[model samples]
Target: MALTIMIADDHPAVLYGLRRLLENAPRSRFVIADAVEGGQALLRSLRGRDCDLALVDWYMPPERGPSGRELLARLRTTFPQTTLVVMTASQQPAVLAASLAAGATGLYDKRECSSQLPRILYQAAQGRLCVSPSLEIVLERHYLTRYHWGQENHQALTPREREVMRLIAAGYTGRETAAQLKRSEKTISRQRRSALDKLGLNPDSVPTLAPG
Candidate 1:
């Protein structure tokens, strides 16, 4: 059976090109279910017919609808059965991470569409996760960074900074921490500021009542 795919892009020309690309694949079995207007329209269209896959653009307009990461999340939550492949040019790590979390089966970069889109769709049809090389590395780095933060905590902190944070986290006063580490109180104060910088904490957000 041919897989049913819907192209949900705002531009008609782009949709036409994508439809042609998939329809004309030499040894492929795919049929165009419909070309939706955008992200919101696709969600509405799903109420009537089921599609095997959807090629979605990241952005959509009109005040009532969601776009980008929000749209990806809604599609996954509302239509879990469809394999969604985000067709976009966005390379931001946060966007990539959010799309994956929202259950995107693949991410096809429009900048590299001509060369990579075919392989992307082919793999999606075969039920595998496919992504553009650049997006893949962005996602890999995103995951590794998060993993290090979650698992090792303070991976971004220097050894001295980590010691400072650890002592502070353990409820030690600046003076007591300095004593414990055999460092001067002034040195402890500077170490705290350095740790805050590495830990991405703002000094303004620090508790005024916190250890001296």
Candidate 2:
């Protein structure tokens, strides 16, 4: 049976291109069930009809509705049976990591869509996790940096400090990290300072410690 797909992107050209791409992918059994231009339209379409997969753009205009991990998360919760493949032009490893953490089954870089999207869709239809090569490299560096930080400072910091550092390295603001860890922002800031000092990292240079 052919896999049915729903596409959601804020750009009309992207919607048209994706629809055409999936419809014409050689040897692939895919059907374009619906193509919509924003999150609201996508949700409306999905409520009225089910599809085997959904391809969503990671960033869309704020007026269109939620974007990024929030959009992926909503789709995952509301339509658990539909496989989600997120498309992004962002090079930030944190964005890619957050998408997977939010339940995306596949990550496709917009730059490689014409060459790699078909295989990504096929793998996602099979329920396999797929990460584009470029995106994978970014994530790999993120992990390696965290590993190095651990190796160098594991004994120097307490567990809470380590946890705070990890979240900070993953792009969370101090306040967001505090909310996630259920601590006060002041406490999070203090822990972050301690962790950075122990790691011999300047707070101003934290962004350089992780891949963006």
Candidate 3:
């Protein structure tokens, strides 16, 4: 039987690229069933269609779209038969760790191409786990170090505060951070100020210490 595959990503360019790649493959080997966002992907799958595997994006913008650990957890319960693979541009240790825990059978970076994807998909189709080559080191370190999820709470920053920290850490200017987070520049400024204050650093200072 040809392996049926589904891909979920927010970017039209990526969706097109993935479709093109898959189409170039030996048609006798694969079939594209559905392509949609995280939520819609789940809904489509639940409609009783059969799929061998699903490639899910690690992050989809806007709330209620599956991303992070929640998406993995949902797939585990909702589609136990379909193998789940997470694809992401991010190399963040936290993001990778959380995705695996959420029940991903395979994890691949978006940077990987069709040449590599086929083998991974073939492995997944055979009930084997497929972890990305690039992330193996990071995942290994995470396991050896005994990293814990939800430990961000130790810093005691609310979700909004964590957003601010990530933007700043990524070196987004205050204005850019505001636009990205959909808040007023003034509000973002205040949140950064408060975060810096709580961390006992000058608000004007660059980050130097780990989150408390």
Candidate 4:
């Protein structure tokens, strides 16, 4: 059966590019069911509908649309059977980890593309957790940490702390987060420590996404 795919991104260029990539490839294997520009529309149009896969942008800016984390979780619930593949421009470890925790079956960095994208999308439709190639090592390390150390208390951290923690979990050192956030290493460390402290986990250990 040809895969039924939906593309959702806030940018016209991105949505167009993804549509073109999937439908115009030399041996296109997917059937473009519909292309939506915003998260809200994507969710609304897809609810109660059966689609094999959905490629969603990590960030969608419309006011009525759910963005980032909420968007991923919502999609998982709203369209339980639809495999979700989050698209992003960054290979940040935390983003990759969090997406999987939130039920994303695939994570694709927009900077990375081509035939591999379709392969992962297909894997996702088959119930596998897929991530960008460059991110696999980072994912292997933090994939456990995201579930064990951070998820339960994720709601406790400040926005800044969450940002710092995601990078740290992604295998980025404090220096990396500092440079990425344009802040001092001390500030990044403090934010990461604060988030970890709030979550009651030690940075030295890796845990599952849901502790039972």
- Which is better, 2 or 3, measured by TM-score? 2
lDDT of 2 by residue, 6-125 (tens): 999998998898888878878868889899888888887899577899999989887888888778888998999999999999977557767777778889999874769988888988
By TM-score, is 1 or 3 better?
1
Pairs with backbone N, CA or C atoms under 3 Å apart (clashes), candidate 1: none
Q: Which stretches of candidate 4 lie over 4 Å from their true place?
A: 62-64, 141-212
| Candidate of highest TM-score | 2
By TM-score: ranked, best first: 2, 4, 1, 3
Q: Give per-residue CA lDDT, model 3, range 105-206, as digits (tens).
A: 677878755577777788877877676777766555443332332133327666887798887788777777777889887787777767655543433335
lDDT of 4 at 98: 69
Candidate 3 lDDT for residue 27: 45
**Least accurate 10 contiguous residues by lDDT in model 4:** 203-212
Clashing residue pairs found in predicted model 3: none
Runs in model 3 lying further than 4 Å from the true structure = 26-28, 145-212
| Candidate 1's TM-score | 0.65
**Residues 1-212, model 4: lDDT tens digits:** 78999988878887787788888876678988888888898988897777989898888885858867898788887788888888887666667656766777788877765667887887888887676786665555543443452255678889998887677657676666677889887777677667767765546543212211
Residue lDDT tens for model 1, 1-212: 78888778888888888888888877768889888777777888877678888888877675536777788778777877888888778877556655666677788988784757768877876778788987776655544343322122357677887788778767788778888899988888888887765654546545321456
